[model samples]
Target: MLAKIIQEGLLNHGFHILETRTIQYGTQIRLLEGAIINVYRTPKVLVQGKSISASPEQLRKNLEYVLPTRITVWNLM
Candidate 1:
Protein backbone atom coordinates (compact mmCIF):
# COMPACT_ATOMS: atom_id res chain seq x y z
CA MET A 1 0.00 0.00 0.00
CA LEU A 2 2.27 2.74 1.26
CA ALA A 3 5.25 1.10 -0.31
CA LYS A 4 3.50 1.00 -3.64
CA ILE A 5 2.61 4.66 -3.35
CA ILE A 6 6.19 5.59 -2.57
CA GLN A 7 7.46 3.53 -5.46
CA GLU A 8 5.09 5.18 -7.88
CA GLY A 9 5.90 8.64 -6.58
CA LEU A 10 9.59 8.09 -7.00
CA LEU A 11 9.11 6.69 -10.46
CA ASN A 12 6.91 9.60 -11.48
CA HIS A 13 9.54 11.98 -10.20
CA GLY A 14 12.23 10.32 -12.36
CA PHE A 15 13.96 8.29 -9.73
CA HIS A 16 15.08 4.95 -10.95
CA ILE A 17 13.84 1.91 -9.07
CA LEU A 18 16.79 -0.39 -8.64
CA GLU A 19 15.06 -3.24 -6.91
CA THR A 20 12.23 -4.22 -4.61
CA ARG A 21 12.23 -7.18 -2.27
CA THR A 22 10.52 -8.49 0.82
CA ILE A 23 12.62 -8.58 3.96
CA GLN A 24 11.97 -10.01 7.39
CA TYR A 25 10.19 -6.88 8.49
CA GLY A 26 8.53 -5.81 5.26
CA THR A 27 9.15 -4.42 1.79
CA GLN A 28 12.42 -2.78 0.74
CA ILE A 29 12.78 -0.42 -2.18
CA ARG A 30 16.19 0.41 -3.58
CA LEU A 31 16.73 3.50 -5.66
CA LEU A 32 19.47 4.37 -8.12
CA GLU A 33 20.79 7.09 -5.85
CA GLY A 34 21.89 4.42 -3.39
CA ALA A 35 18.92 5.08 -1.17
CA ILE A 36 16.97 2.31 0.47
CA ILE A 37 13.40 2.71 1.73
CA ASN A 38 12.13 0.04 4.05
CA VAL A 39 8.41 -0.17 4.58
CA TYR A 40 7.71 -2.16 7.72
CA ARG A 41 4.64 -4.20 8.50
CA THR A 42 4.06 -1.96 11.50
CA PRO A 43 3.47 0.92 9.07
CA LYS A 44 6.85 2.46 9.71
CA VAL A 45 9.23 3.54 7.01
CA LEU A 46 13.00 3.85 7.10
CA VAL A 47 14.83 5.85 4.46
CA GLN A 48 18.60 5.52 4.31
CA GLY A 49 21.21 6.94 2.01
CA LYS A 50 24.08 9.37 1.76
CA SER A 51 22.43 11.55 -0.84
CA ILE A 52 18.96 11.77 0.63
CA SER A 53 19.31 15.15 2.23
CA ALA A 54 21.49 16.32 -0.59
CA SER A 55 18.95 15.32 -3.17
CA PRO A 56 16.99 17.90 -5.13
CA GLU A 57 14.27 19.92 -3.47
CA GLN A 58 11.52 18.39 -5.57
CA LEU A 59 12.70 14.93 -4.68
CA ARG A 60 12.89 15.81 -1.02
CA LYS A 61 9.46 17.38 -1.06
CA ASN A 62 8.04 14.45 -2.91
CA LEU A 63 9.39 12.12 -0.26
CA GLU A 64 8.07 14.29 2.53
CA TYR A 65 4.65 14.33 0.94
CA VAL A 66 4.51 10.66 0.13
CA LEU A 67 5.94 9.23 3.35
CA PRO A 68 3.82 8.77 6.42
CA THR A 69 4.27 10.08 9.94
CA ARG A 70 6.17 7.03 11.17
CA ILE A 71 9.26 7.60 9.12
CA THR A 72 12.97 7.63 9.88
CA VAL A 73 15.69 9.02 7.68
CA TRP A 74 19.35 8.07 7.83
CA ASN A 75 22.21 9.84 6.18
CA LEU A 76 24.97 7.31 5.63
CA MET A 77 27.62 9.57 4.32
Candidate 2:
Protein backbone atom coordinates (compact mmCIF):
# COMPACT_ATOMS: atom_id res chain seq x y z
CA MET A 1 0.00 0.00 0.00
CA LEU A 2 2.76 2.43 0.85
CA ALA A 3 4.57 1.78 -2.39
CA LYS A 4 1.35 2.15 -4.35
CA ILE A 5 0.59 5.41 -2.62
CA ILE A 6 4.02 6.81 -3.33
CA GLN A 7 3.92 5.68 -6.90
CA GLU A 8 0.52 7.18 -7.49
CA GLY A 9 1.47 10.42 -5.79
CA LEU A 10 4.59 10.79 -7.85
CA LEU A 11 2.69 9.98 -11.02
CA ASN A 12 -0.05 12.47 -10.19
CA HIS A 13 2.47 15.22 -9.56
CA GLY A 14 4.55 14.31 -12.61
CA PHE A 15 7.48 13.68 -10.26
CA HIS A 16 9.36 10.42 -10.16
CA ILE A 17 11.36 8.89 -7.37
CA LEU A 18 14.18 7.46 -9.41
CA GLU A 19 16.11 6.62 -6.32
CA THR A 20 15.35 5.13 -2.90
CA ARG A 21 17.61 4.92 0.10
CA THR A 22 17.61 2.84 3.27
CA ILE A 23 18.33 5.25 6.10
CA GLN A 24 19.43 3.57 9.29
CA TYR A 25 21.49 5.10 12.07
CA GLY A 26 21.84 2.44 14.77
CA THR A 27 20.05 -0.37 16.52
CA GLN A 28 18.30 2.12 18.78
CA ILE A 29 16.09 3.18 15.85
CA ARG A 30 16.41 6.96 15.43
CA LEU A 31 14.95 7.61 11.99
CA LEU A 32 14.12 5.80 8.74
CA GLU A 33 12.99 7.25 5.45
CA GLY A 34 11.90 5.98 2.03
CA ALA A 35 12.70 2.32 1.67
CA ILE A 36 13.78 2.16 5.29
CA ILE A 37 10.40 3.32 6.51
CA ASN A 38 9.21 -0.26 6.12
CA VAL A 39 11.18 -1.10 9.27
CA TYR A 40 9.54 1.55 11.51
CA ARG A 41 6.12 3.02 11.75
CA THR A 42 5.76 6.50 10.35
CA PRO A 43 2.98 7.48 12.71
CA LYS A 44 3.15 7.67 16.47
CA VAL A 45 -0.56 7.66 17.18
CA LEU A 46 -3.52 6.67 15.09
CA VAL A 47 -6.62 8.77 15.60
CA GLN A 48 -9.69 7.91 13.57
CA GLY A 49 -12.66 9.42 15.31
CA LYS A 50 -13.95 10.42 18.74
CA SER A 51 -17.26 10.08 20.45
CA ILE A 52 -18.88 10.64 23.85
CA SER A 53 -20.70 7.34 24.23
CA ALA A 54 -17.77 5.39 25.61
CA SER A 55 -16.18 7.94 27.88
CA PRO A 56 -16.62 5.83 30.99
CA GLU A 57 -14.28 3.11 29.73
CA GLN A 58 -11.88 5.56 28.15
CA LEU A 59 -11.73 7.78 31.23
CA ARG A 60 -11.36 4.80 33.47
CA LYS A 61 -8.36 3.63 31.52
CA ASN A 62 -6.87 7.04 30.74
CA LEU A 63 -7.51 9.10 33.88
CA GLU A 64 -8.46 6.36 36.31
CA TYR A 65 -11.64 8.28 36.89
CA VAL A 66 -14.71 6.44 38.00
CA LEU A 67 -17.83 6.76 35.89
CA PRO A 68 -21.30 5.43 36.26
CA THR A 69 -21.97 2.12 34.56
CA ARG A 70 -24.72 3.67 32.46
CA ILE A 71 -22.51 6.39 31.05
CA THR A 72 -20.42 5.95 27.94
CA VAL A 73 -18.59 8.28 25.59
CA TRP A 74 -18.25 7.09 22.02
CA ASN A 75 -15.53 8.42 19.76
CA LEU A 76 -16.82 11.55 18.03
CA MET A 77 -13.74 13.53 17.29
Candidate 3:
Protein backbone atom coordinates (compact mmCIF):
# COMPACT_ATOMS: atom_id res chain seq x y z
CA MET A 1 0.00 0.00 0.00
CA LEU A 2 2.83 2.38 0.80
CA ALA A 3 4.46 1.69 -2.53
CA LYS A 4 1.21 2.29 -4.35
CA ILE A 5 0.70 5.59 -2.57
CA ILE A 6 4.22 6.68 -3.39
CA GLN A 7 3.80 5.67 -7.01
CA GLU A 8 0.56 7.61 -7.29
CA GLY A 9 2.06 10.63 -5.61
CA LEU A 10 5.05 10.56 -7.95
CA LEU A 11 2.76 10.23 -10.92
CA ASN A 12 0.81 13.26 -9.78
CA HIS A 13 4.04 15.18 -9.46
CA GLY A 14 4.77 14.71 -13.18
CA PHE A 15 7.49 12.14 -12.63
CA HIS A 16 7.47 9.76 -15.53
CA ILE A 17 7.58 6.14 -14.53
CA LEU A 18 10.12 4.43 -16.72
CA GLU A 19 10.60 0.90 -15.44
CA THR A 20 10.94 -0.98 -12.14
CA ARG A 21 13.99 -3.05 -11.43
CA THR A 22 14.17 -5.57 -8.61
CA ILE A 23 17.39 -6.94 -7.20
CA GLN A 24 18.62 -8.82 -4.16
CA TYR A 25 18.89 -5.59 -2.22
CA GLY A 26 15.50 -4.00 -2.86
CA THR A 27 13.34 -2.27 -5.44
CA GLN A 28 14.35 0.57 -7.70
CA ILE A 29 11.75 2.81 -9.28
CA ARG A 30 13.17 4.30 -12.44
CA LEU A 31 11.93 7.71 -13.38
CA LEU A 32 12.26 10.22 -16.20
CA GLU A 33 15.40 9.53 -18.21
CA GLY A 34 17.85 8.35 -15.55
CA ALA A 35 16.38 9.25 -12.18
CA ILE A 36 16.53 6.14 -10.02
CA ILE A 37 14.98 5.77 -6.57
CA ASN A 38 16.24 3.11 -4.24
CA VAL A 39 13.69 2.14 -1.61
CA TYR A 40 15.13 -0.27 0.84
CA ARG A 41 15.42 -0.12 4.63
CA THR A 42 15.81 3.59 3.85
CA PRO A 43 14.88 5.58 0.77
CA LYS A 44 17.57 7.14 -1.39
CA VAL A 45 16.91 8.64 -4.78
CA LEU A 46 19.66 9.10 -7.35
CA VAL A 47 19.17 11.91 -9.79
CA GLN A 48 21.69 13.44 -12.13
CA GLY A 49 24.84 12.73 -10.15
CA LYS A 50 23.56 13.21 -6.62
CA SER A 51 21.60 11.02 -4.23
CA ILE A 52 18.96 12.27 -1.81
CA SER A 53 18.37 10.23 1.27
CA ALA A 54 14.80 10.48 2.48
CA SER A 55 12.81 9.48 5.54
CA PRO A 56 9.44 7.75 5.60
CA GLU A 57 7.72 10.98 6.56
CA GLN A 58 9.53 12.75 3.76
CA LEU A 59 8.44 10.06 1.32
CA ARG A 60 4.86 10.56 2.38
CA LYS A 61 5.18 14.20 1.45
CA ASN A 62 5.07 13.27 -2.26
CA LEU A 63 8.84 13.69 -2.55
CA GLU A 64 8.54 17.45 -2.28
CA TYR A 65 11.98 17.71 -0.75
CA VAL A 66 13.67 15.95 -3.67
CA LEU A 67 15.02 18.30 -6.29
CA PRO A 68 16.23 16.15 -9.18
CA THR A 69 18.65 17.21 -11.84
CA ARG A 70 18.51 16.56 -15.56
CA ILE A 71 19.81 13.34 -17.13
CA THR A 72 22.47 14.77 -19.34
CA VAL A 73 24.88 11.88 -19.45
CA TRP A 74 24.14 9.39 -22.19
CA ASN A 75 25.77 6.49 -23.94
CA LEU A 76 26.70 7.23 -27.50
CA MET A 77 27.56 3.86 -28.81
Task: State every prediction's TM-score relative to the real structure.
Answer: 0.72, 0.26, 0.48
User: Which whole-number lDDT from 0 to 100 does residue 11 have in model 1?
Assistant: 83
Cα-based lDDT at residue 38, candidate 3: 56
Task: Using TM-score, give the best candidate's number.
Answer: 1
Q: Native-vs-model 3 lDDT? A: 0.47
Steric clash pairs (candidate 3): none
**lDDT tens string, model 2, 1-77?**
33344345434543333444443421111111111112113412111233233443442343212212232232223
| Stretches of candidate 2 exceeding 4 Å from the true structure | 25-40, 44-77
State the lDDT of candidate 3 residue by residue for 1-77, as single tens digits: 33455567678786677776674555667765334565443333332312234433433343453332231122111
- lDDT against the true structure, each candidate: 0.73, 0.29, 0.47
* Candidate number with greatest lDDT: 1
lDDT of each residue in 15-64, candidate 1, tens digit only = 88889999987899988766778988777888766555355554455567
For TM-score, candidate 2 versus 3, the one ahead is: 3
